[model samples]
Target: MAVIATLADVRDTDPVDLTPLQSTVDPEELDSLVRVRNGANGDTHVTFTHEGHAITVHSYGMVAITPEHELTAEKYERGEGR
Candidate 1:
């Protein structure tokens, strides 16, 4: 099963800091492949991958390592991730 990890969860588990990766990517590009929401704490964000696309989720954020299988924007809108 695919797992979801929050920023806090990542910090607790991983020893290496991921500030560099977070700074490199555009937040808009990240949003293109996944949905990010402000966590309850308001300091961190929770990222959810596009369904069926098992993305490699790092500590800073989520990335679509593999190309997404053909799916229309309408289909994506029907579901949660867009």
Candidate 2:
């Protein structure tokens, strides 16, 4: 997954690059994880922590990211993270 794409959807500002996620999981791995979760659960979602933010990627092509401080965990878990 492209963190920049997901971040762009959830955040107000546009990120020029994913440099901030350099220490996080590889983008390819993230993409692979989403693919696996989608395949295993048939369009389900999988979430993980990245840079202190909770990131959820759904098989329906929705990516929701909320920081811990925002306390949007319930919304994200309900697939309403947007």
Best by TM-score: 2
Query: Where's the lowest-lDDT run of ten residues in candidate 1?
Result: 1-10
- lDDT accuracy of residue 77 in candidate 1: 77
CA lDDT, candidate 2, residue 5: 67
Superposed model 1: Cα runs more than 4 Å off: 1-5, 13-21, 35-82
Q: How accurate is candidate 2 locally (lDDT)?
A: 0.66
Q: Backbone clashes in each candidate structure, one number apiece?
A: 0, 1
Query: Which one is best on lDDT?
Result: 2
TM-score of each: 0.24, 0.55
Span of 10 residues, lowest total lDDT, candidate 2: 32-41
lDDT of 2 by residue, 1-82 (tens): 3566677656655665444664665666667656644344677666777655788877667778888666677778778887
